[model samples]
Target: MFGDPIENPKGWPRVELDEVLDGIDSGKSPVCLSRPATPGEWGVLKLSAVTYGRYNASENKALPEGTAPGQNLEVRPGDLLFSRKNTYSLVGAVVLVRETPKRMLLPDLIFRLRLGEPQMLTASYLHQLLMYPSKRKEVRSLAGGAAGSMPNISKGRLLKLRVEVPPMSLQEEYARVVERLEQHRRLIGAQLHCLEAGLDSLQATAFSARL
Candidate 1:
């Protein structure tokens, strides 16, 4: 999507989020069940399913019997999801869906963003921008609710947020950097797991020797 890669352009233009969104749709609640539903039962997405720049479809809960998910509620890869209501710290979390192994319906408190022109705003780019610490803080500041209850950001206020629109080339570069960093993080995590296993084995060996 890069157009003749320009080097170090001046300031990027700013655009209101509403200008880029075709529509914002919230999810519906499925019947609440004490435990997870079977494969044939309805499954509803949890707000935790979407964290900053990450989507975990597996975090969904199973809905009770006789519950039905709304049409098109199932998340597709590349969909931009936003948390409409949550605790103060998580009120405005956003994420981009990379994959979905099973069909899971979105819950009532999450909003799905449909882009007006997909090419104009890359999902990866937008997700990264929203995940920025400063931007997230700004979002949290906009949230309003009761004195001792969950906070909520209205759709109008959320859509009114101004975002910087950098060149598509730069956005693509940022996406690549994020991908590399994620790969490195995974490698480090694996190494840590191995080290923990080694330590456990050493402890086991020492205990056996004492026996």
Candidate 2:
């Protein structure tokens, strides 16, 4: 029942990620016992940084000096981060770094990708591809473990992921479309949160009046 699909869409290129990328790496775990750092330092990003296909800076954790640099991994703006271990639905969640403070670090369970030619593969496109249902299924299948627990995708499997690349212009266009959709989703989410907060406040106020 599968329909015939175009092998290569016009203005698109068929290429694997390894072909156009350099230095695909993940972060190291911070030492829990490390001392705290002074003010004005870098923060460490956990899987919590990524949510619903976006980066949430509000939830990031600050790193102490011992885990800041020469002790922990460093990340930068424009780098792509992926969740390596999480709930089935959260696994493979991706985010594009929009800003970088000094000594930014990623936890061991997350991956950081540094693109060789940023023009060739836009971070937005990569994020979309990884979030695709088919790709997520593939990642889940590769995950090894017992049922009902967090599963992990090995480094070898991650590097071997096949990515279909579109031309830079088309990629940018797709990114814009995805971005618009994401904005709408975020708006809806905010509205829901506000509604929930209002309901909670009303309930509390009513209870207080009765008291």
For TM-score, the strongest prediction is 1
lDDT digits (tens) for residues 1-211 of candidate 1? 3221122145567788998889898898865765554676667887778854578776778876566567588878778999989988888899877667556788889999888866667777887667777778877887998898899999999999887777778788878887789779779989999999999999998999953
Q: What's the TM-score of every candidate structure? A: 0.78, 0.68
CA lDDT, every prediction?
Answer: 0.78, 0.68
- Give the per-residue lDDT of model 2 (tens digit) for 37-131: 33476666657877566676545566654543533366666778888788877777788876555555677788877677555788887776777
> What's the residue-level lDDT of 209 in candidate 2?
95
Most lDDT-accurate candidate: 1
Q: What is the C-alpha RMSD of each candidate to the true structure, in Å?
A: 4.9, 5.2
TM-score: model 2 vs. ground truth: 0.68
Assess candidate 2 and give its lDDT.
0.68
List ranges where model 2 is wrong by over 4 Å.
1-13, 32-39, 65-72, 100-102, 146-149, 176-211
Number of clashes recorded per candidate: 0, 0
The ten-residue window of minimal lDDT in model 1 covers: 1-10
State model 1's lDDT: 0.78
